[model samples]
Target: MSVWFQSTGRKMNNSSEGQLDKICESLSQAELVAMIELQLSEVDMLQSMFPDPRELVVEDPSVLCDLRDFAEGRTLLLPPHLDLIINLNVGKGRLSMSANLPHHYPAVQPNIFVRSQTLNRDAQHRLNQELLGYLKMLQQGDLCIGPAVTWLQEKGETFFDDHPEEVTKSDANTMETKVIKFARLWIYSHHIYSKVKRKDILDLSREFDLTGFCLPGKPGIICVEGLSRNTEDWWHKVRSWNWQKILCKKLEENELKAEEDISKYRRFSVFEELGSENNIRVKSGGFHVDMGDVFKYLENHESGYVFKEYFGISGRAT
Candidate 1:
């Protein structure tokens, strides 16, 4: 019975292999050659347009060799995908784009990754999403990289224009003494692994000029302190975002006598993500913040008592 089963399995495997060969044979060699030619021509055009070797990097040069081999009929299968990293000057900063062309590239959309130091992570994410949406609207077999670059060159600066520096500048220019109501919020979440969520947290905090820190990992902790209105707005926006489990664990509010008195109520000078610092030990496999580091941070800030509020433990012994 075992020998009969083995023979049946071998026959099934041979049938599948034969079907794969038939599919490969059905693909037009001429069409494959045309795709390779188009890709090669596009690479040349990109190099010519950029005119700077530093601006473009072909991640795997072997892909080009494979293309040549397939074009010359030396190989039966299509070549591996072409990977390109392009750096472009946009506004006051540089935009780095990684474009991966799949085997049937112009017919299918390329995977795009966009990064910019000038824009915050949220802005970068929005820009990349917009670019992807633009690609999807294009007709199939469209050579897309050039148009994508053009789109970035034209509209990318808008993302950088709304930097946190603008908010800082606006605050600095205000000369009137305003009575500020301060508020601090402690938020707890089941986990904070999503890049988009982390970016949103940073962007929202900076937009509202909130100062505190976010410990992003399993059992994420967020602390934001600022003008009562701004902190409320931040919390409102945050709550609108999707979360598996999130709650406002604690809320502290106080009225500052004057703008200068804000220091008395504020515990943090800047909004930042804190789990990756030298003082913190992140658990392996996941970005888990150490409770000991959290206690130390709170102790240094003279807010160590809140550790009990966060966890039932009276101290960091657990």
Candidate 2:
């Protein structure tokens, strides 16, 4: 790992044009490795505002509605341009959201309602009302879903509990477009309870993304349809036999453990901090290796909770 990182860095620093081609190339490789190896946690990804994926960003109401409209309530999808802030004085420690159609990304200044130096009575109340509306939507929003299942007892379609491993050549030839989108949720919370409030939450613990949450016992009731793609590729493997082998491959081999050097535990302190005495225990493979002052070594940094979920992705399932 040290050699690989050092080599990549050397190649980038030696470039004459100083162009980002080499650096970008390395990043692309790193990203692909991260996706396949790390299978990153969704819960932690949303701790900060993340720039929406270019392809996934939806600005049109129709697009958003068609994807997630469960009931009749039309909760407006806030544009990426809008920003939220907190005003402690006026709204009594509540959050205040303001918008700016600034010629730039944020044309207008962020008018916050709560803060140390910022406190306006009317503005705080207006923001409070708006937040209340969102809370209502979150609490009672109609649940729009895709494909159906007998679980909900609403007469839906059948779903696959596991992915298949093998397929026939004749069937593969009939395939149209090959694409399947998965889902991952970022739930912000420390423990489970009847009513979970925002301020009490720490952060999203885990994310059951895409097909990961589509299992029979999974907690996801969401939809992930192929936009312009056909459903043939998805349906073929649905009924194929020997599905358990494929599942074993995915679950065992493709475990999304957090990034940490097993031989030399650097981030192990996080385990103690989370109050994990037994569950967070590490099983060192006996053989050990260490790097003295290896600053260049970088594979993928991961949240400790992700490692904790290594064999327990089923916890989020119903």
Candidate 3:
């Protein structure tokens, strides 16, 4: 292994920018040799772990060209905007990241950018910050850039699992222009009993940007409404579950019209959190629901009725 930390700290702590760049160029070459040797030594293990090149999206000619230039002591122009976009599947959702290697590469971390339609701006920034943090955590002389893609894939998967509402694609046009817009999915199952299963359904629903609930009973019923593609994606996952019967049908114009009539009141949750109790029921159904009657209804038929719980956050869904 390269005694990178010792040399790096000494050279960097003493040298000017021009001298440091020259020294970094030599260090980068040695690091490349070490990386190549390491790869060759562990070729079989790597091949088994990562058999498909398509999964990484780092084998493109542009990437090769940039690395070649860097190796040849050439300072390539940094594009004002993102030069390459790589799409990756992170958990149930997809993610895209644009990245460029700095000329000083192993010495200085690569410039990675995220323009996320999946996550909010703050989350996007956090992802980049965390990636940089991970790079900083690495011991010197390691294949520093090698960890970035893997780290992103793992971290992003975890983030999506936790948030569940942050999947995005590079294309936003489809979201706005697609017709046959709204869809309702009715998934029927007998096996969705445990709290774990319920939470799984809730997480999946949020991931696909669907709004619906699991009606508590022996045979479970899940109702969700969203854009057709998203609803279809949700249905596909529902079928994957060990469900007795899963049937999905598009809601007609008449049904949508009826839903539109109550659209104004739809924002009002029938169930609300007051103090200590969960799942308070609303009796009077208008834009405004009486809390006193809601509490009374919860008290009366709490055990008898199976209430469908809505776990979706309104603005978070795509």
- Candidate 1 C-alpha error for residue 293, in Å: 25
Tens-place lDDT digits, model 3, residues 240-288: 3333444542242212332244333232223222222434332332223
How would you encode candidate 2's per-residue C-alpha lDDT over 190-245 as one tens digit per residue?
Answer: 22221221111111111111121111111211111121111122222121211111
Model 2 gets an lDDT of 0.22
Candidate 1 segments whose C-alpha is farther than 4 A from its true place: 1-26, 166-318
Top candidate on TM-score is 1
lDDT by residue for model 1 over 18-135, one digit each (tens)?
Answer: 3433533444667557556677777888988887778988876788888878878898777666878799998787898877665444544556767765665446657877887887
Q: Which stretches of candidate 2 lie over 4 Å from their true place?
A: 1-171, 174-176, 182-184, 194-301, 304-318
Ranking by lDDT: 1, 3, 2
Query: How many residue-pair clashes does candidate 3 contain?
Result: 0
Better of 2 and 3 by TM-score: 3
Best-performing candidate as measured by lDDT: 1
lDDT of 1 at 9: 32
TM-score of 3: 0.34
- For each candidate, what is the lDDT? 0.72, 0.22, 0.46
